[model samples]
Target: MSKKEVETTGHSWDGIEELNNPLPRWWLLVWYACILWGIAYTVAMPAWPGIKSATAGVLGWSTRAEVAEKIASFEEMNAAVNAELAAADVTMIKPGSDVHSYGVNMGAAVFRANCSQCHGSGAAGNFGYPNLLDNDWLWGGTIDEVAYTIQHGVRNETDEARYSEMPKFGADELLTDEEIDQAVAFAMSLSDPEGDGTNLVGGTYDVELAAAGAEVFEYNCASCHGEDGTGDIYQGAPDLTDAIWLYGGDHDTVYDTVFNARFGVMPAWGQRLTQAEVNAAALYVHQLGGGQ
Candidate 1:
């Protein structure tokens, strides 16, 4: 028997003839399989967009529900520890105790989630933010103090917030430009014992200008900053004696602070976080080696 000849397409290019060929059975089967799979997938999972939300598939699974369930599990696991932290007195929790350790761990998480945005991941602080790892606290560094500050915040709008207003000597016309310069010199002298008013390099003190500036400081700044420039924590006056500065410690920076003043604000965590979270954050900060 002779084999049947395949027919050529009606159109041809040059001398070449084209044959219309059917798709491979295997290829067609695969294409059909894909279509069926897509239909099944649409039925089994959320695939269509709706006016308010996505379509609820037969499986009824939701990413939000999954996240909620995980959060529930985490809360369940930490319920007892969180309860203890909420109830325990922040001052009485000794450093090496289990509760203290737990607070430190949990507080670290809280700090990362919330405080890290301002204080940095390691709490080293940015230019305006205060460092947490050091012994220089604008407010008192005691555990109770730390807790109180965290709860009520500093310069926040809350009634119980730690509030202080640094008078802008230049802007407010409280001090002449020359007097402000003298005040800056005196403030610098407090931190730099050997610094002369002429140069910041540590050396023999500039007795003459320092003496002059001291009078200026005593007359204007001593009310809140203390006669010795040790700063009154109760008044939120930053200690000038320490070289550590929330703003820069350089002469220009000091002049700006004296002239314009600084009023940094911290939000009241008590309004945002639960009592246990607040206590944990306080404990974590207190244990960071700066707490008094």
Candidate 2:
């Protein structure tokens, strides 16, 4: 049979005649290749959706399976290091060993990613955060204590957590500014009293101000700070009598503390990391310094 001619609308513009056009040879070939490639790809790799599943393909490739395999390989590579960490006691992971250094590096990663929000890069906490580098710890600084704290955070509102509350000085009306200042001065005096050797050497303390501050301490602070200005650690209170200060020992530092109570918290790591990682982190923190 003869082929019927294709028809076009009888219209012409700009001296151009409109004609019915057949599929272009190049375009048809490209479209054909795409269809073939799609079929081949579906057969070789996972593709095509079903009611409840997808075609497995000849290679059986899957994103989830690939991820799992990668993770498995990584775990295998670190198997020996993890075993060593698990076998050793926390105290043994101090500053001198290879394991100690590795643990420190790992712990630093964890601290920066998770703990750095509150505990500054140097572990020097802010007004509400406790300085981890310092010896003064609310819960405890032992390797086990550090580990426990990481596992069960503070005020975590969970079963396994270290919890405590510091009175809001100004909010609770616990002490007036003048009274707080006096307490602050006394707290500072515990470490360096005016006219004392440390104060004289520093030349920062005011004699008359300290004398007035002493009275404030006697009335408002003596109860918790103690008569000799020695803080009770059992109460989660810092020892002002010591020269070392977690925040700062300067006049302004002391004054800030008195005006506003400081409440610090540590999140529990137990939920976030494997037991092995938590143990390593604890040892790492303990060895940072001032660990008892």
Candidate 3:
């Protein structure tokens, strides 16, 4: 048979004729394959959106289900370690042991998921939040003490919560502004003696003002904070001499702390975390440089 001539559809742009060509067989086949694939995918997997949920396709597979299975597996894997941690005494756990290491690792994960929101990812706290890495602890820094604090929390509604309330000297009219200022000055003298003393002989404080402030402090703050300002752990009174301030250590910060007072609240974790988790977190925190 003679070769057939290709025909033009009679459409022209700038005197250039366009050929009436059918799509290539391979391209047509590929396009059809795509259409079939789309239909198959819609039937075999979740595709259509519904008011509440997507359509559960024939495979019955779901991403949420997969994630749940993964979590269950993880829990199962850690079950033995968690059991050991819960049974062992927090103080008895030997440092550098496998169990201790596991607890620390698990504790870090738990801290990241739960505690990090308030304490920060690095456990370095902000203005109100207490720094976990520091030596200054309002409650106590021992492993058992830390565990107890984690379990019971601080100033929470829970009965076992470590509770203390500093009197609002300014807000409640317990102390005049002058007295509060004097107290602030005295507190600063305790921490920054060099700056607050009159001369090189007397350290950094104004001896007379500090003396007056001392009288005010003795009358109001000494019961909980101690005469030397060393702080009493049982009362949750922070040490004023060390210069580690939860709110701040400056004069203004001291004035605010004395006048308004600070009431930091930590939620009771006993209800939220497992006993093992609480112990593990305590161990992890204890090993973080400042743990007594």
Candidate 3: give its CA RMSD in angstroms.
Answer: 3.4
Q: Tens digit of lDDT per residue, candidate 1, span 1-292?
A: 9987778777789988898677799999999999999999999999899999888899998999999999999999989988989998998898889889989998999999989999999899899998998887877899989999999999988999999999999999999987887777777788765554433333223455566788899888999989988898889988878766778777778788988999899999999999999999999988888858
Alpha-carbon local distance difference test for all models: 0.85, 0.72, 0.86
Tell me how many clashing residue pairs each candidate has: 0, 8, 7
Question: Model 3, residue 85: displacement in angstroms?
Answer: 1.1
How do the residues 1-292 of candidate 2 rate in per-residue lDDT, one tens digit apiece?
A: 9998777667789887677788899999999999999999999998999999999999888999999999899889888887887677776676778787777777877777777787777777775577778777766777877777788887766887776565667667887777676666556666764346244124255555677878777776667667787766545666676655666677776566666666656666777787667776776677678658
lDDT of 3 by residue, 133-184 (tens): 9888878899999999999999999999999999999999999988887787
CA deviation > 4 Å runs, candidate 1: 1-22, 49-53, 56-58, 198-210
Per-residue lDDT of 97 in model 2: 80
Error of 3 at 39 (Å): 2.3
In model 1, how large is the Cα lDDT of residue 257? 90
